[model samples]
Target chain A: MLLSRMVPTGFNDLRREMDRLFQDWMPGDGNFFRPSVFPAVNVWESGDTLYAEAEIPGVTMEDIEVSVVGDELSIKGTRKPMPEGDYTFHRQERGTGEFCRFVTLPMPVNAEKVEAVLKDGVLSITLPKAEEAKPKKINVRTS
Target chain B: MTTATAVEKREGKVRPEPTRGGRIYSPNVDILENREELLLLADVPGARPEDINIQYENGELTIHARVDSRTEVGEAQFLACEYGVGDFHRSFQLGESIDNSKIHAKVKDGVLTVHLPKTEAVKPRKIAVKTA
Candidate 1:
């Protein structure tokens, strides 16, 4: 079947047209509203460890690199392009390319203890708080 | 300049049926068509393979994936909350007829691929010209 003939001109097409217009008007990269960062990240802290998560579908562990230096965490990866063939695209939305994101942690972390895991296309990093950065309990005595 | 903006978040349509209690997101997808079949690829991170459900009925294909909460809200203090963790739901209306028995799907690295083969009647045929 000629599936491309059945492609619908829906809201997504309209949105794409609007984006193209805005991009054409601003060719010098001077626009005030920048696009959102890639690999949108979510970070949280629990107990003495901080966690960061990113959704990176279709990315393999071999192509991903995670590192922590002092208070900065960096994630870098590349998504390979689909194999070339005789297929015709009806709708293209997912992106494929190299992406890198750097996030500054709120507190100093033990870089030696940082751990990262990739599961089900989600990357989760655990950063343990540095000894000096952790909250300490002070002793109370009767005066 | 290698960095590109992530896919925009589109909330899934609210369904009348009861849910397991979490926001519903519409996963980004790409559709491709060849002479043999139509291919659909959807990005659904954090969803287990067994939790995905696909249905084709009335010239419409629907995809739903249930995702378990990764972290408890009361336990962790969010420092930067940019994306939500929840289930995914999306549906597409198909205008061409497909061979129901030949349809198949697979998931790997959080991406789901569904292949819908066209019926024999719709497949393109080549005719030869001969001299009389």
Candidate 2:
């Protein structure tokens, strides 16, 4: 399988260099900093509840930790590397290390009713909105 | 300018189909070569075992998977959406040394593994020394 990408030349190379320059300054944990965005995540709202899903393949359920305080949701986990031995790698695109993603909900959510499930290497969390946070529709009367 | 045009042409010509018009994503993969076979491991999160599709034809290998919906539309409120839910699609061209018939695949915890065994003709053989 072909893994390495072709080296860009000319103008494309200039853009590539610019990208590298910006990526190096992004927020990171210093010693373990990587140029990737890490495990991808998505957050949306449904009815009175807010849902968040994150792709965290190769991580076991025990390795993950989820916490919610008011509107802030935090997910922490580590993806362990495969066993080491006598093997030559043809392609290595998957990342393995510790990762933490913190997301602040748009609205206040009840922390007591939050539920999280890890299935098929994806973590899904459901946070119900507090009683006062739900939208209230007012009826209009014309005289 | 030239490279940009070439990229656009490639994308236009080779587009992978996504279910329900969902975006196309590429899952991370690791390919390792052993003594007898090559093992491929792909991280296809949110995809069930039944949703994964693997195909091999004309020395090319392709993998596709459908991601489940995270939230219902319109009913929910807008929030942070850094990542998207889409069907994963990736393809790789293989050489003639690989034995396609013996290839096997398995999925667990959203990770798919494909084993490609080397053909007997290409495997290393130990020659016996002759004593005169």
Candidate 3:
């Protein structure tokens, strides 16, 4: 089965295409192609585990929350504003606010065995496939 | 009184140097200035501390971060790939002289903060007034 056909990333493709168009029109500046969604994510599957990764820089572990209910996963977090100080901003491209994103799994996963880790500003979640979701091989006996 | 100019997005420009191989991305950054120094914050997720290199020369500051591939080649089947994973490279031109010895930088939660202290002559100073 094709992975792309199984997992649906609603509006992500359209957003990517729009980003590309803007990039072509206005080159050099990186902020022009930023997607409207905060903390872009990538999902892939290997063997019996399904993995999801999101890039949320400058956010501490305590500020972010991850939950998995059934076949749906949610990532919610807030990027706090910079500390109060007397300074003038010449360029402010990074965003600061509350954001929540939900991703639907391609197949049922073992919620009990799910694990998530945040390292170097990247959050990686590992969801193991449920017993029923794993592919099973059938043995044939000659009659 | 604190005054802010129009937010200009033309802060950093991507260099034309060819990378080792693979995709190279320009990380987003914020530049702030004060009476004493200029602060730069950049987002470079998935890049280890050891892999980040910062160099200042010829009135230009360059930041290069090396990131390893998350998955093996042709190993995992991607379902929804939104962002590309690769090295981050960008450079900025400094208009004022910087105190190279006092420069400091640190990375936390994939964000890199660089402190570029302005030279003594460039820093704004308050003149004392006395009654004659």
Full ranking by TM-score = 3, 1, 2
True-vs-predicted CA distance for residue A76, candidate 3, Å = 0.5
Please, what are the lDDT tens digits per residue for candidate 3 over residues A1-143?
00011111223334435655677667554334345566677999999999999988888999999999999999999887775678778766677878898999999899999999999999999999999999999999999
- In candidate 1, stretches whose alpha carbon ends up further than 4 angstroms from where it belongs are A1-35, B1-18, B130-132
- Candidate 3 global CA lDDT score: 0.77
**Sorted on lDDT, highest at the top, how do the candidates line up?**
3, 1, 2
Where is model 1 chain A poorest over a 10-residue stretch in terms of lDDT? Answer: A1-10
Give the per-residue Cα lDDT of candidate 2 at A88.
Answer: 76
| Docking class of predicted structure 3 | medium
lDDT string for model 1 (B29-116, tens) is: 8877787887889888888889999987765678888888899769899999777787777777664467878889998888899998
lDDT of model 2, residue A26: 52
Return the interface RMSD of model 3. 6.6
TM-score of each: 0.83, 0.76, 0.84
Error of 3 at B116 (Å): 0.4
Off by over 4 Å in 3: A1-33, B1-16
Clashing residue pairs in candidate 3 are none
Better of 1 and 2 by lDDT: 1
Interface DockQ of each model: 0.42, 0.40, 0.51
